[model samples]
Target: MATMPRLLFLVPVLVGLAAPPALAQSEPFRVVNRTTAPALALHAVRSGRGDWGGNLLNRGPLAPGAFFALRPSEGAGCSFDLRLVLQDGQEIVRRNTDICTDRTVVMTLSGAARPVVPAPDGKPTPLPAPAAATARPGVAPGARPNPQARASTGTGFVVGPDQVLTNHHVVEGCSRIFVRAADGRTLPVPQAPASDARRDLALVRAPGNPGPALAFRANPVRRGESVVTYGFPLAGLLSSGPTLTTGEVSALSGLADNQTQFQISAPVQQGNSGGPLLDRQGNVVGVIVSKLNAARIAQRTGDIPQNVNFAVKGTEALDFLRRNGVQPVLRESPGEERSAAEVGEQVHPSTVFIRCER
Candidate 1:
């Protein structure tokens, strides 16, 4: 799983200012869907109240290039909350409202908002290289098995000695989970109590292994900091033990749920969830949760930005694990945690290529 880079615009300043003293002026704007598909039954929701006050039902599906004007009542001008809600119950809320006058509120319904092309500098930037097979101190290397022979492979991390972290959906209904270490060892994951699905996380204990204590960091990460993600994507078609992807923190606290989480530009695929999102200092900052997919919105005729991935904040996960009585083997200091490049160098042999039957 590699991190993808994304470009986002800052909310206009006028959207956040206090309304004029006079009650005669009201905010005005337009809503537009700029994707290839139409947005079904879109509605504007007022912020804070969780209610839709405007009743401009898009009679026909809003085609890719179609837009509708939103006007405020006469003699009533103030900052108003607005959002786009689809018939399928998906919603995209705007954090700011700058409706001082007529404006073209163009919305991108599908596909990723275009990335900012880097300036053409001849200097070569180091792209993340593929994982190489190298043994870490005290950890042995493992062999690679045929990927096609496996039924399914789920990505996870060693949270404690002989303990792993993953998503319940990744191992749901499985009688046993195969645990692969970075040193090329494979062990069975024993049944462990799982947390509620509202958080979408799970924990498993490695079988018969008192492995090394894992490292953790609790500091909140600021947006635009360098981040590296590690996971087995596509069931190991990519390297088996922690494929590393690099990107920056795109956003924080912008999700629909308004939860404090990281919006990383990491390139992830199916089987990449439950992996660690590490900061530049090699400390775990968050857990990879979901990848942004534009095709799904296309199918539903709804608008959503693509390449937007979400992570569960590490602090939240740590709290959840503590509340659930799952104790992680935490390292004492920064010197104890291995760097991403160092971990990448030594983790190949300890991981196994998992193949499962459907």
Candidate 2:
């Protein structure tokens, strides 16, 4: 028989995601299914490599709320990509999963719905576009609200000498705008900011020379292409440094065919509003904007939305910069792909945390 691509198993629905309990090296990894449907099969392959292992479940179906332990290979890396098959024939694919770090793979309904095949080379495999969901009548679309009630924070990146770019709402109605670099140097915006409320982008100038400018890709971003972003989301709750998230271009347009934005699957929080969304080659492609209001959507549809986030397209941002007399840099062509961590290292110097004081 042909070698199975990887270990096969399944997890059921999990309501909320939390850090899993760590197990000793000798212990096996656990998978918890809390989904509505029974998991038919589960398979996994080491991220960035292609090879199959024996079934983690020993060829048994994973029922809802059921748990199982998967022993690790004798000498394998920590991260792996997962593929879970449900009884309804729908599947889910999650990439760069660190089984040891997470410990338990608690599957959610919406998270386990998107079916994708893992590419052997770590590239995104193309899938047909999913049909847009119709909203309930009279339910308004509220993009995740900016939490700038008193003093709020967001993220920005350097595009030109002494110039930083972020969302308009981040600095809107603020008495002061301050930025903190990765090295813990905090500086205030000295000059008036160039604002474009229509596009939800703002360019501010702070003291000191920037390390290096981030470049936008010359070519357009394709749907299903892998993307990464760096930002300081959830300012006080999370780390003082930038956090990185990776996903794929889920759609070419934002909600309701808004061409100015791109829908991405990379998770973003409130403070991510103005972060840079980069392609696999470390080129700017979009500005982290807003995520669909899951609470509102869940209230209306009874199903929670997952990773339904939006970003301002880099083309529009570049245009905004030029219209305001700032020349944004652009890469000549596409290059070899690199890991998200490598891209974040180069982006660290350009990205900063912005605090808006009203």
Candidate 3:
């Protein structure tokens, strides 16, 4: 049987796009889905890469009438090849497109002419743009007020006697934020957090001390290395204390080969963000960031990828803290291996429950 063509390359695409009438000003750049069918998969790679990185659409397919921004790391290279898979299982390939220079890259199923808008001045807006219809990287379009005062929770860990580290998105628009220690005492986050939204990191101080801060590993993490994570997942719905889960380092890079993050096999959940990913010796290696949206991935691939989760590398977190004038307590991993229980007990005090109320 003849093999089906999975990809269809559109070569020599004329480089011009006209701003559509429905385009919002705050969404400075976007991938307008002008096609009638859903855009099933999206992939991008540097100009010369042999293969594309992880599918950028893992969050969910870009359905008809929707669009996505091309978010790259700060100062990353501009030239990239974009691959868009359509519902009919046909792929659209655009070669060496300069996302760094364009305001928006639109996807279409129809061959009808699209008005080429003038290129916006300067570099392209970053990908995976915030769900909010805004121009900022991580800021969502608008805050939906929780009038009923609903409670949402996530995880964090201590970096110093007073400073706790967590994901900025976890506490983005909170009217009040608090940290709960293992002892069940709730401490207030006295002031606003110092955050790096692009990196999704936040540094906030607790009134009193939580406990001995967890230490960062001095060396880089390797693939297949055993690791562990602790967090208060599904808080108020699960046990009151922190939960520990263990796995091995599946990959050195994260989704789309992001070097600043790790692809871990360790299981994580909504409440696991900002929790620590530790080595066998109880040294911090990374911070649990997110897990693949398995349901969505399965919808596209027809098979679920097992145990694919991600974490921010410790190096990135360390740099963020230092830039903010907070030096983390760094330590080297001991040669000795500790049991999961022992490591859990040693790090438990540093793990904290982060609560946000609007």
Best TM-score goes to which candidate? Answer: 3
Model 2 residue 134 CA deviation in Å: 39
Off by over 4 Å in 3: 1-148
> lDDT of each structure?
0.52, 0.71, 0.69
* Candidate 3 similarity to native, TM-score: 0.61
Give the per-residue lDDT digits (tens) of candidate 1, residues 90-142: 34443233344225555653322222222368322223322221111121223
Query: What TM-score against the true fold does each predicted structure earn?
Result: 0.51, 0.58, 0.61
Q: What's the C-alpha lDDT at position 320 in model 1?
A: 67
Q: Indicate whether candidate 2 or candidate 3 has the larger TM-score.
A: 3
Best by lDDT: 2
Give me the overall lDDT of model 2: 0.71
- lDDT per residue as tens, model 2, 8-48: 33221211111112344323566666677777667666654
* TM-score winner, 1 or 3: 3
Looking at candidate 1, the ten consecutive residues that score lowest on lDDT are: 12-21
Please give the distance, in angstroms, between residue 94's alpha carbon in candidate 1 and its true position after superposition: 34
Error of 3 at 13 (Å): 28
